[model samples]
Target: MILFRGTGAAACRYLESDRSRADDYYLEGGTALAAFTVTDGGGEVLATSELDAEAYAGWVDWIDPLTTKSMGKPRLPGEEGTTKHGSPRFAEMVVNTPKSLSIAAALHPEVSDALDAAQGDAVAEIRRFIALHSVTRVGPRGHQEVVPVERLQTVAVVHKTSRAGDPHRHVHFQIGTRVWAAGKWRGLDTAALFKQQGAIRALGTAVLAAHPGLAQVLDRHGLTLDPVTGEVAELESFNALMSKRGAQVEKNLAAIEASWDEAHPGQEPGPVVHARMTAAAWAKGRPQKRPTTLAHEDGWRDELAEAGYDPELFLQRRLPAHAPIDVDDLKIQTIASRSLDRCAAAASTWTRHTVAEKVTRIVTEHGVRATPA
Candidate 1:
């Protein structure tokens, strides 16, 4: 599953800071920063040495002034309001792995490669969609323009376990808000990017399904496909277990909101108020348990069997020759079509140029690359 969150400049600053403790190593003596970019395309360089913290901080701060600020009052006709600066300058894209895939990655080298391939495919699809759909205004009259994000910079951080010490594998994609377009930097229009999150998630499942061993393992462990969508479900047992902390956070937030409402009377709580409440809830914290006390892989398998999945049948099943569908091509076409349709509906005069330019760029960029699995 892919979870998305738009963050403020302060959050971005903290994420790049030493206090963030993003120091979890994937390899011996290796740093957590896996990749960084400034483009929306697939070309990103993996870090050879340690992450350049100063560069990351600089990038985040450069776009901070461009973030949407509080207006303090309502606007008159033609007056710019909160959205004048566009959306938030930082967003987090979290790609979560299934329990089966997580365990497989830990226990088998081949599975790790499959996981990497699946993750790569998902990320590429996401970037493609964002490139095609990102829209921004160019002039004082709020002229709608399709500013395709040619380069999207991101810091990909992989985590092996959850904060609760559960067996979890996920990648945090810290995407910068600025993109190169029309010979200068522009604030990214993330409305479409956020809208197509479901399609992006489906692409991830489809790509993972292309890996036969991983699919079978997932099936045996109760991450079976939904009959209608062919999308796999996360192991409910594990998901529910790990959601305890989040549930508590939600509960605390609710209580805080209620108290604020009672005190404030008719006034609605704003973003800043909600943010403070959430921060206080997080500060309260949850008890940590050692991972050593968690259930082993075998225990999880046994639990799956007990949950009514046919482990024997899952083991006997052969790998499908192909995925249930052409995930890569289908996703690309879907996003492009959606973007073009929206442009047409909006009576955009630049529709032809936008479509032509985006198509040419996508084809030229991906033509030399191998097809995704």
Candidate 2:
């Protein structure tokens, strides 16, 4: 599974701070640095600065000074803007654990390499998907045209456990806000990116399925899968346990929000305010135990069995066979079908030519070459 969330300066600070643990922050493709230059679509350096709390809180003025003044509200350094609504300074793509591989890695430390390989493949797929799908429109009115963003710069941070100290392997991909395209920096068309998230998740699952050894490990561990969803139900208990801290934080936030609403009357707080509140709440409500003890394999399996999931069935069941289809073609077809379904839902009619044109535009926009018939 993959989740997307827009983050503000406060959140960015939390990620870079010691609170998140320095060891978990991974600098993909290079070593870590205090500050770095933001680049344009052509890979030209735009600005050099550290993306610490100060930078994010004061970024609106630097990024769009004219607009900041016109709005009549100056954002203080370290303060998430209270008036700004839709402008997200950064985006996070959370790559979640594949149940089978996660369980395997937890039980047998030796399988960590295979798990890493699978995760690497998942990340590569996500990067390719982003390259092809990341786009923005340019020009005015009728002259508007869609163009792909040529580059994506992200810091992929891997975490070994959930906030509740449960064994949860995931990556937080911090994607830069300003993307390069058409010889300039432009805001990413995140709506399009969000639309393709499901496809990207499916692609990750497919990549995992390609690794037979991982599946065999799942079988050995007694993790049964749902015949229909192909998802392992046994992991739900673990997920629920891991989610306790997060659930508490959310509860605290909800209470805070309610109090704020009561005090503010007709006014609604912006994303910045919400982010600040959420962060504070999270910090205050964090569990006392920073690290959790890993259960023995036999004990973990017993717990799963106690949760009513049959371990015997997990051992007997086999993973569904991979469908024989070209991965690229499958992606294209899936996107096309989704597009058609949306059109149908909207009661919009399209001729064959129109559908073909739409698909062609998507293919061209993403730089996907058509497979020879």
Candidate 3:
């Protein structure tokens, strides 16, 4: 599962350099948060499963509109975690909203509910959340930019082959702030969402007691059960528990592998045997030849020279210094520039006529601005 947050521009920047690595990590169920303060800092979520390619495509189709593009690239593996640059694709990080306000909580109704919902509708819920929080506003110069918010960008769920996560799935979402229909954005105090005693208690019962011995080890590792909910606690405590559990599980697996090697020295089968009787199989037809791709001698001249092989011809090709900007790049650059402009405006003073005059001059000279609406 990959959770994306922040501005599309920021997300694009992160994606360009490490798209492959990011995808690799995403398959591992990592969350990626991006937000563009200069643009609407909405968020998006993606879950990765071993679905067939068609199912994967279906998932993308369901999620594409909510996000900005088909090439779903979260923050590249090495970029900073937060989305600060303004990208049209950028959205906030999504995490668990309060149980009361969470759409997942509402859909599930009961924590153990197994009811299935339509994929389209589920994706709609996600899109609704993004649109409801996306920034859209006109500034002093009637410039548009996405306003930044500390919203949950995404939640990721990773299903492992073994008893990872006690088989509990889904990375939760917690969103704060509201993007109103009136094109205004406001912050929502979502701390109350985390104050659920029942949830806490449930966590304690389900995860903490799943394996009691492991629970004791978790406690020894500075991980503790919450007093009020009797559930495994969060923040640093949850991380500590996970780390310790992972280490123990790894150790156990290593021990099992070592034991297997000791029990069976080289091969597990009884013993290698040589058969006494053998008959030769005859092929009476013409031999099959391997196929090869067409080779161009013209292009091989440079390589041939380097390898000390003279060539009769050389291919001359001129490559451009830069490729055309893609939609994502344009969006990111626009958002970034706008953000810088906003900052500059904030740090300075201005008069209304001065702004109007500038606008008038532009309108008079260019007739209209055609770059971005």
Candidate 4:
């Protein structure tokens, strides 16, 4: 799955890369943690490719990246109660690996390595999508027009688990909102990113499913990606087993809502207030990291063993060898018909994007890929 979060300048508190202690190789701009790093491309504006605490502070606060001094303009009379520069500092896209994939990674090093490579490849593809669709508005009010721009300022932080300590492997791909377009810093046109979340999720999962190393590893371990759901084909039952974190959030939300109803005595909250209440509930529900003597991966293994999952049985060839699929004209016609029907069902108005997303859905669900020359 993919999640896009709009963030103000001060995302560093949680957005900072995990700083675990281990034997580490140094990166170009800064030190490397086991999981991720902060990078910078140029020294001018956003400077780093990885996450930088000081530079990020400056970047979000509208200060010079090198100088770390405030460059924020004095607010205009009407510009009260907004971000430092009246624009969000960054947009975060979370690319999450499937639960079964995460469990597989914990079970084996080869799976872990393959998962990393697949995730990297998928992230690169998503970046290309961002570069192609990124835009900025130029000119005044009614006369304004959107122009394509580049968003080179990106930081990806790979995380291993959810706050509730589930085996959730994901990357936080944060795109800096400061885009250099037409010799000026401008806010990115995030409408594309927001509007195409489903497409992004589909594309990312498709890449994971077809990745050679990852696919080979899965096959060896008697696993395969479900063409439609894009999760471990044999592990549908894992959903109920692995939804601890999400379940906690839901439980907390219910409790909070109950309390709110009691306090308010029959008053219904407006949309804005309800949204804030939900946010508060999430934060309240978020679990703090519990200190563990055993290594995290080791702990996951123990849990799996206790759950009665036999590794030997898992390794045995379970999925059948591929049978020849007849991709005849009728199959093509059926796919087309289903794609169009899905588009119609999804929206009243249709555009190229809508059709494209629906087609992608149909293609992925069937595990279809472009024929190589």
lDDT of each: 0.48, 0.50, 0.28, 0.59
| Backbone clashes, candidate 2 | 1
Ranking by lDDT: 4, 2, 1, 3
Question: Taking the tens digit of each residue's C-alpha lDDT, what string does model 2 give over 131-189?
Answer: 55677778886998888776544445556444333345676655555565777666677
| lDDT by residue (tens digit), candidate 3, 1-373 | 1233443332232232121111232243433332111112343333222333232232222233234334333343346863453112222222221211111211122321311111122223443334334343435546744443433332222211111111122222223233222343332223322232222223222222222333333333333323223233422222322222333433443454356547776432211110000000001121242101101212222322444432122112212211222223334454445545544575575443234333322222222212111
Query: Which number leads on TM-score?
Result: 4
Off by over 4 Å in 4: 1-9, 16-48, 62-78, 81-86, 245-295, 321-337, 369-373
Q: Give the worst 10-residue stretch by lDDT in candidate 1.
A: 16-25
Per-candidate total of colliding backbone pairs: 7, 1, 38, 7
TM-score of each: 0.54, 0.53, 0.23, 0.71
**Candidate 4, residue 298: lDDT:** 73
| lDDT (Cα) of model 1 | 0.48
The TM-score measured for candidate 1 stands at 0.54
Which residue pairs in candidate 4 collide? 38-50, 38-51, 39-48, 39-49, 39-50, 40-48, 40-49
Error of 1 at 125 (Å): 2.5
Superposed by TM-score, candidate 2 places the C-alpha of residue 305 at a distance from the truth, in angstroms, of 11
| Candidate 4, 30-82: lDDT as tens digits | 64321222222221232334335555555555554544554344232236765
The RMSD of every model to the true structure, in order and in angstroms, is: 9.6, 9.3, 27.7, 8.4
